[model samples]
Target: MAEKKIDKARRNFLFGAVRRFKNEDPDQIEASTAECVDLIKQANALYVDGDFEAARDAYRDCLKSDQNDADIRYRLGVCQYRVGKYRQAKLEFERTLRIDRTYQDAFLYLGLTLVRLGKPEKAPALWSQYFNIKAVVVQRELNLQIGLLENGESDPADTIAEAVEKAIEQAGSAVG
Candidate 1:
């Protein structure tokens, strides 16, 4: 009974906030969303320009308005990654994939996040999924690694495919 009351209170508070937001001028809201998008774009550009903190702030503001936007979420994750916020980036990537399972970029970035988190086995699966969904660059990178292994340029167990699969298993706690 207490739990239900708490839930009801939470819902009421949320609905009140939404109502207040809705009561604002539509033009202002549209402008804000657009500005948020622009901020995200600017953040990406700034990241490319090597300004990580500014990018992070811009992405955060963008997310405040459109939290479910997968692209923005992924970009925010990437910015977090660039700033060495691996855990936060991992969460953002996970959220992005949850919002859009077919989001190849999110999968790829998730793999990269796992790598940063030092769980190598999981990284490879994400890399593989990314290869399958958007195969050109990732596939080429994997194939190149395979070729290197064939030539004995790298350890067999550390071949990109094996490495990725192992990373997945390790991340899943299947490995010690």
Candidate 2:
């Protein structure tokens, strides 16, 4: 009897909360969302003013609600890079790319981060990848032959096809 009473109370409390939310005005919700936009504007202003630490903190606060925002993530990475926190910057850049692979600026910043970490040799590939994204963007209008792999699907290698098939067969592979 006590457990049943507790469950009823919990259900009533949740329903009351939902009803209160449903009664709130849509404009109120939009204004709340816009607070994050305002924060982003403030962060950009701070960054432009060379106050990277403040900008970084503001960006992080915005990210708490919109964790998947690539632009904000990229800006945070730039702030970290400016503050000489190469590792954190690298992580932010990597996360930005993981969220949106077409983000070219992340590639550029990631390369710079690598160079700062004393891995100059690895930076070229990052730069090339950045250019590849640019090439793809520009190629559509310019009609230029900028070789960019737009998709993961590719024609099977002719030379290794049979050998690879045989090896797979030997290993009892079920790959189609």
Candidate 3:
């Protein structure tokens, strides 16, 4: 009877410990997420303050914490670019795109990086791809807006086709 009581006590203790850990797991995860967001905000502030090296270091730290974050990789590449590290920036941008194939800004920056690396001819293809992606996204957004207007959820303004033409013109100017 004593042995049975002891065994039951041990089991109860173990179960209570496990329950406590399970309850705390979400708090730990939330703290980690908050820390990561703080790091990103700090890195962006450093970049905006013209401290490219510091921004790069912070971004590197963030990458160490989350290597799969394509946005951080892209920002790190921009910092590298601002610091005149074209080769490293190019690699970083490439990595960003590898992580997120639909990242349009990475495509633009990669094209610019190629231009800086004296490979102007290579930029055209990237630019073309960037424009194509932009066109698709813009078309999708315009279609949504048009649908909203048709359903009376949005006020009717200019036609969707006109908006698309204007967006294309803007995109062309931006590319040139």
Residue 4 local lDDT, model 3: 21
Candidate 3: list runs displaced more than 4 Å.
1-33, 132-176
lDDT of each: 0.62, 0.62, 0.65
lDDT of 2 at 9: 37
Most TM-score-accurate candidate: 1
TM-score of each: 0.59, 0.57, 0.57
lDDT of 2 by residue, 99-165 (tens): 9998876876686677567654555566566543223332231121112212322222232223322
User: What value does the lDDT take at residue 60 in candidate 1?
Assistant: 82
Q: Per-residue CA lDDT of candidate 3, range 133-163, in tens?
A: 4455544544554455446564323343345
lDDT of 1: 0.62
**All candidates: CA RMSD (Å):** 12.4, 17.8, 16.2
TM-score of 2: 0.57
Ranking by TM-score: 1, 3, 2
Q: For this target, which candidate reaches the highest lDDT against the unseen true structure? A: 3
Q: Judged by lDDT against the true structure, how good is candidate 2?
A: 0.62
